[model samples]
Target chain A: MDPINFVILAAILFAIGSAAVLLRRNAIIAFMGVELMLNAANLSLVSFSRIHGEIDGQVMAFFVMVVAAAEVVVGLAIIIAVFRARQTISLDEPSELKG
Target chain B: MVNPLLFWIIAALTVIPSLSLLFARKAVHVAMAIVLVMVGLAAAYVALGAPFLGVVQIVVYTGAVMMLFLFVLMLVGVDQREDLKETIKGQRWIGLLAAGGLGAFLVSVVARVALPVQEETVGEPDVIAEVLFQRYVLVIEVLGFLLITAAVGALVLTHAPRLKPRRTQLEVQRDRVRVGANPVNKPMPGVYARHNALDVPALDPEGQPIEDSVSRVLKIRHQTQDGAEFRAQLEDPARKDTEEGR
Candidate 1:
């Protein structure tokens, strides 16, 4: 199979992830959509690295993974904080100005 | 180049499970599906000559990231259902259409422009490390700082401050007495000799069963036995005589 197919798969996953972010009302699920998008980008990066015959793409993917990890930590902490204050993780409910 | 069959398998693994993110009602099920997608991506990385990246993907995404998601999920609520009502009329369709268009555009653009495939080196740990340390060492140092900051940030966000002093047992007792509550402990369940069980209520001085002796949860569930019946049988002198003869 052409390695470009990997890119196509990544695009498809990215689309699904976006759909999730838009459609899902739950904060955790939406956060997971973000994770999915990151993973899709990583897949595409690795595929590009393979196509170009260099380790640079893989290294970039590594960096992306680190950032994604950090993002997950802070994001989940915020989710917990919001849930504690509002007692609901629905993204819509927290849209009101007052805490 | 990935094997056609292998790519198809990976595609199936990723694409099918990822749909759950949009459709699955339970956040837990969606989380699990995303995990599967991560694994599939890891496999694709390995297949495309980046084994090192593949391993990191599995360790980081499946092990750490998804586990954190699950922990938060449980902390929030395992059975927490989403408000599926779309407040913005037709918002779901609009979102799906936009995403689908984006995907179609990307695939067409990529497929049309034939990027030459050349697999020079398998991304083993040592090979990846050489590149990582030499060119990206500074990035790595920054990442370490980021991780530490994230850990501290998480602690700060979730940490609940002590708003009030903890009420001690003595203070609690004093408050109960002031409120005119029964300061003494309730009698233990199972007052009778033959029927010593938690569901059996102890009798008060007035010969009435003390309902509070049994657990409130047990009473609510109708799991408690009536101590009144046992007390009545015991009080019957004729029944006691028959019991003694037997």
Candidate 2:
């Protein structure tokens, strides 16, 4: 399989994820979009690792996974708190800080 | 030669559900879709010869992180639908255009740039660990600290102080008297009542236990008979027959 194919796939997935983040109103779904983008990047990293005949890309992928996990934890906590306070998880609902 | 067929199949699996994840209306469905995508990505990782990352992707993202997402979805309840009204006018169209432009640019760049392709090397877990713990030790430690900070920050954000502060027995009694309601007798209103002090069974004002919608639809009701009598009748068919005959 051509390594460029994987890169193309990753690019397409990242684009879909970006579209989701842009278009979705639900904060959780937007968060899922962010995760999808991260996964796409991880795929590219693994592909590059294979292309380089080294383990560095895989190690970087592992670090990305760890960071993604931590990010989800904090992000979900903030989303839940916002939901608790305002009774909505819609990103546009929290306009108090908009000004 | 690497199997292109497997690569195409896994790539399709990874991409399809990730796109669907965006369209899922309910948060729970979105979470499940993301899990499917993560599993597909893990398969892709394995196909790329990073077995360790593939397994870790499944264990961490699909297993733990997705579970956390599901937990939050359930905790917050999935019944609340998001308001679809756009806060910023024409944002959706602009976003779509931007994303499309970005995708085209990336694909073109990837096609044009010829990276030197080396022979595929299967990542050995031992070498990864050695490099991670030796050369990238500081980075690993920093990630550990970030995780801890995330945990603490999550707790701080979501923690709600108890509505009723801790009070002595006398203070509780005085508050009950002052409020002109017996704290021990009256049921607390609202979904988040701290405790059911009266040990009252969950029942409506009609003195009947609230039946679930499914049970109501099925026309099922609780038996009025005692537990011991119900057990005896189940144990002896003859006795039940005699009672019916009588």
Q: Best TM-score goes to which candidate?
A: 1
User: What tens digits encode model 2's per-residue C-alpha lDDT throughout B1-246?
Assistant: 348998789888878888775577777877887898889888888888888898999999999999998888888788878787877899889989998898899988888867777877787688788989999999999999999999999999999989987899999789878988745553332121433322223445684543331223233354222233434656798986897899
Best by DockQ: 1
lDDT of 1 by residue, A1-99 (tens): 788888888999998888888888899999999999998999899888988999899999999999999999999999999999989999889767666
User: Candidate 2, clashing residue pairs?
Assistant: none
Regions of model 1 farther than 4 Å from truth? A97-99, B191-194, B227-246
TM-score of chain A of each: 0.96, 0.97
- Candidate 1, what DockQ? 0.84
Error of 1 at B208 (Å): 2.6
TM-score of chain B of 2: 0.68
Considering the two chains of model 1, state its CAPRI-style docking category: high
The TM-scores, one per candidate, come to: 0.91, 0.78
